[model samples]
Target: MRLILPILFLTILSIKAFSREVASDSLANIARNAMFTDAYIQIEGKLHSKKLKVEVNLGDTPEQTKAGKEYSEKLTGKSHMLLS
Candidate 1:
């Protein structure tokens, strides 16, 4: 029904907004705990380097999961990563 679709959409949007709020807060925590002081990334098949879709997660150094995200984002033109 029409009403069902609108209700579903609203619920999904609210859930997304809430999730983002939570994730950002976690980002602050991660940054504080991150192990890597700083990082740079490389892109595949690109002659010139560019920085995009960039965000640094918190840790003293970059952990595997966080670094993997940065690496995948850099390669978005050629590939993307997803968590399950």
Candidate 2:
């Protein structure tokens, strides 16, 4: 019947929307868990107004610094300062 089709369509649409929301929430949780507080990026200067500088201090350890340098270069497109 027409009513049955409409109800089924609405149900399917709602289910799809719910799934998307759940997927987004899970992705957010994953990103939150993966946040690196020790490794960060610092922009020391203004952009277009002054010499824009990017400072990255990955960590105190050498290994951490090395990884931070690589990540910084990748993120900033090889334009910035990486302080160990």
- lDDT of residue 77 for candidate 1: 58
Error of 1 at 44 (Å): 63
**RMSD in order of candidates:** 15.0, 8.3
Highest lDDT: which candidate?
A: 2
The local distance difference test score of each candidate is 0.57, 0.68
What is the C-alpha lDDT profile of model 2 across 1-84, one tens digit per residue?
A: 979999999999989888833578888889888956565677655544335445578788888888878765665533344444
lDDT of 1 by residue, 1-84 (tens): 989999999999989888833578788999899854444443344344343344334334447557767666655654333222
Candidate 1 similarity to native, TM-score:
0.25
Which pairs of residues collide in model 2? Answer: none
Candidate 2 runs further than 4 Å off:
1-37, 48-52, 77-84
lDDT, residue 17, candidate 1: 80
| TM-score: model 2 vs. ground truth | 0.34
